[model samples]
Target: MPALDKIRWENYARNLAKGMTQADAYEDAGFTRSKQAASALANNPVILQRVEELRTERERILSGPTVFDEDADTDNGEPLVEVTMEWVIERLAANVVSAQSTGNHSAANKALEMLGHHLGLSFSDKKAPSGDEGKPGSNLGSGNTFNILSLTEGLKQHAAALEQMPMKDVTPEDDG
Candidate 1:
């Protein structure tokens, strides 16, 4: 068999990297449309290597940071840093600390929760069985032990107290 044309091989590899089907790419590379021929060409060691190279190059280009300004270039910019799992975790940890220092308990809690979830230390709403089933004052086995009646009554009382109390502006001022 004669060696494949360099242009056709490059075209086929480019098409494959662009998500084209083997048969479609082979045809687009100026080859006769035959499923068997396309499959054979696609499975060729040289073609497969070229396709992998193209895919890797495409990924490198896509993962790079984008520059919005047409006149600006990234040639002299700082080295590109890939976003890793460790980097994300560190940022989240810093956020938790920063929020706590600023007296934002809610934000700190949220950041801590996110960090916990990312680290696989997730908190679940489902309660574990306590082996206290059928015991007095133990509502184990039945989902949720809190008294609904008492909860509703408490909420009503709290609402009434809030209505009786004087309202104050609690919104934080923008530091920016």
Candidate 2:
């Protein structure tokens, strides 16, 4: 129950994120056998519950962030700090599609979860997106179907997932 240092990991965490297993991230982050000892804590219910509180605080700090808003004009436009589930998916899609080169949904979703962290959205990559999230003039693609995003992330995530998916599953279907 100790307090998190709030240590600014900066880009350090991102570097370790090049398609790492949750196990890898847990170790690389320097927790000492804690992920194993506190496996339940790994998916901490309390942490998830306080997400809204943390998010609001994060927004307050990032309100005037140094990163320039690409879709904004200096005087008229407001910074669109989009924190949508769909946007999170799109962001993670890069890795998802790459990992899914051989075709897999599970791998793509894992990629999405990791990438979602970077995008300030905590979501599972497995959960497919629904309607009404797409923006005006935006073609965010349909479902978890074979889209560029999922396809790409799948390629990266497949390094782990493929190892998990047994070779027997890849056999050509028997046509009876």
Candidate 3:
């Protein structure tokens, strides 16, 4: 019936914006206990407006910046800001330097070999994909009867259904 205090409403709005329940926000705002009172305060027009504003502000902050453009092949021939070849090389060099400083030749060599796969400087540790088609060794081995992604998804659903089925009950006479 009456408007909530400005400070309490603001506190309630902030908590509500963070996905807290209305009742929780009401109590957390430091208001006196009473479900009916809390409910009435939460439903007040001014409190509702504050909650909306806080929610909008939160949405804006979460969606702002820190987004990657996956469609673009490269950042105009420039190395990516994160995970660039130069970055990897720099890290490997740093590892070697750190190892050498501690008189750990093994560690230094290990760092060098870390990037060996990409640079072809050392033997690859990856298992070479066998030329077998539809076999266990390959991605879609002999067991995989269907190659279509949609069909594969259906097979997964079927497997899930099989797992959900109750086990068959057996009696001693039935077993015999």
User: lDDT for every model?
Assistant: 0.62, 0.44, 0.56
lDDT per residue, candidate 3, 77-122, as tens digits?
1122335575566556555555766789999767755644344333
Per-residue alpha-carbon lDDT of candidate 1 for residues 1-176, written as tens digits (9 for 90 to 100)? 12235878778877887899999999999998888998998898988877777677557756765424333333222233445676566556555655766899999777766765564454445445676655654542233233333433543454465456444444589999
Clash pairs for candidate 3 = 134-141, 134-142, 135-141, 135-142
Candidate 3, which ten residues in sequence have the lowest lDDT sum?
Answer: 71-80
Residue 43 lDDT in candidate 1: 91
Model 2: CA > 4 A from native:
1-25, 32-39, 50-52, 65-176
Please give each candidate's TM-score. Answer: 0.36, 0.20, 0.35
Expressed as tens digits, the lDDT of each residue in 1-176 for candidate 2 is: 22233331211132122334445545565554344633443355543333334444445645754334454333212244546665454445544655566577788667765764554443323423455455542343334233445544644564455455433333467799
Q: In terms of TM-score, which candidate is strongest?
A: 1
TM-score of 1: 0.36
Question: Between prediction 1 and prediction 2, which has the larger lDDT?
Answer: 1
Judging by TM-score, tell me the better candidate of 1 and 3: 1
How much does each candidate deviate from the true structure in C-alpha RMSD? 17.3, 20.2, 21.6
